[model samples]
Target: MVAPRKYPLELRERAVRMYRTSDPRPQIKRLAVDLGVHPEALRGWIRQAEADRGERDDRLATAEKEELAQLRREVKELRRANEILRTASAFFAGQLDPTRPR
Candidate 1:
């Protein structure tokens, strides 16, 4: 399960917007201190905003990343279920064999 974010969505958007609109982009650490957020977190938000705007292509867009995570979880669940079913099928087949004593 995803953990709740410490910073609200509005706050993140505002910070990213401010960073984008500033005449001279401020240093990430300084801006983070002013906003009471970690510098690395602030930098991530900026990178994500740029990716959303098509200005950067260094990483997957947010939606794509989320979808990928969801898909990976589904694949894992499927693999687990397949293993359980395979084990059950083998057990049932052995039970039905007349060659073995009950």
Candidate 2:
């Protein structure tokens, strides 16, 4: 399960908007200090926003990240199911073996 965000969505959006709309781009540290948020957090948000906007290529956009996470979860579940099926097949095969005593 994912942990709750330290800052609200509204604040994140507002901060990103503020940074993007400013004529002179603000320093991340300074903006974070003014907003009472961690500089790294703000930087990540900016990077993600840029990715979403197609302005950056280093990181996946929000939708892509979500889809990746979902795919990972599905792969995990399928692997677990396959393991269970394999174990069950082995157990049935052992039970049906006639070479050993009943």
Candidate 3:
């Protein structure tokens, strides 16, 4: 069995671009044959990359929406707590200074 060779990322990106372009099938096949790799392998790489790009975009949008929701809840709770504290402070102040109250 032949040992599999490691390919660089730039090479893979180039291969994917070539596979995705409007080149004729025969030309693509000849390029793959010259590179000693299957034409289908390059085509599959392009397809998988496209799928992954869309999936990543969707996940990023979902995460941002979740984070925004959590932040809004936090702001609401904090405002409620602050209002309660202010009300209590006013009540105590009135009770302590009723003699010369303004």
Candidate 4:
């Protein structure tokens, strides 16, 4: 039986990088075959990475706080924009009202 890898992260990443380059398919296939893992698993890893490309944090408890922090920053920016818009709207409304004396 093969020794289970507690940390395949680095090696798996290298293998994925090799696969993406102009490296031959046979070489990639042979690497996976020698690793005793299905080729599709490598593809799945790459796909998952691509899917999470833009997502800074994942759906984990620790990441949740990071996500919340990011969301709070975004909300603060939005609130500022809304306040600016409201100010502009009020100024325009006051200027446009015909019944109010200039």
Best by lDDT: 2
Name the lDDT of candidate 2. Answer: 0.94
The C-alpha lDDT values of all candidates are 0.93, 0.94, 0.69, 0.68
Q: In lDDT terms, how accurate is model 3?
A: 0.69
By the TM-score metric, which is better: model 3 or model 4?
3
| TM-score winner, 1 or 2 | 2
lDDT of 2 by residue, 1-102 (tens): 789988999999999999999879999899999999999999989999999999998899999999999999999999999999999998888899978665
Sort the predicted structures by TM-score, highest score first: 2, 1, 3, 4
Clashing pairs in 3: none
Q: Kindly report the root-mean-square deviation of model 4 from the true structure over all alpha carbons.
A: 12.0
After superposition, the stretches of candidate 2 with alpha carbons farther than 4 Å from their true spots are: 100-102
Q: Rank the candidates by lDDT, best first.
A: 2, 1, 3, 4
Native-to-model Cα distance after best TM-score fit, residue 16 in candidate 2, in Å: 0.4
Worst 10 residues of 1 by lDDT: 93-102
Candidate 2 weakest lDDT stretch, 10 residues:
93-102
Candidate 1: tens digits of C-alpha lDDT, residues 1-102: 689998999999999999989989889899999999999999999999999888898988888889999999999999999999999998998889979765
Total clashing pairs for each candidate: 0, 0, 0, 0
- lDDT, candidate 3, 16-86, per-residue tens: 67666745644656767776677777655565666556744423353465698889999999999999999
Which segments of candidate 3 are over 4 A away from where they belong?
1-60
* Residue 84 shift from truth in candidate 2, angstroms: 0.8
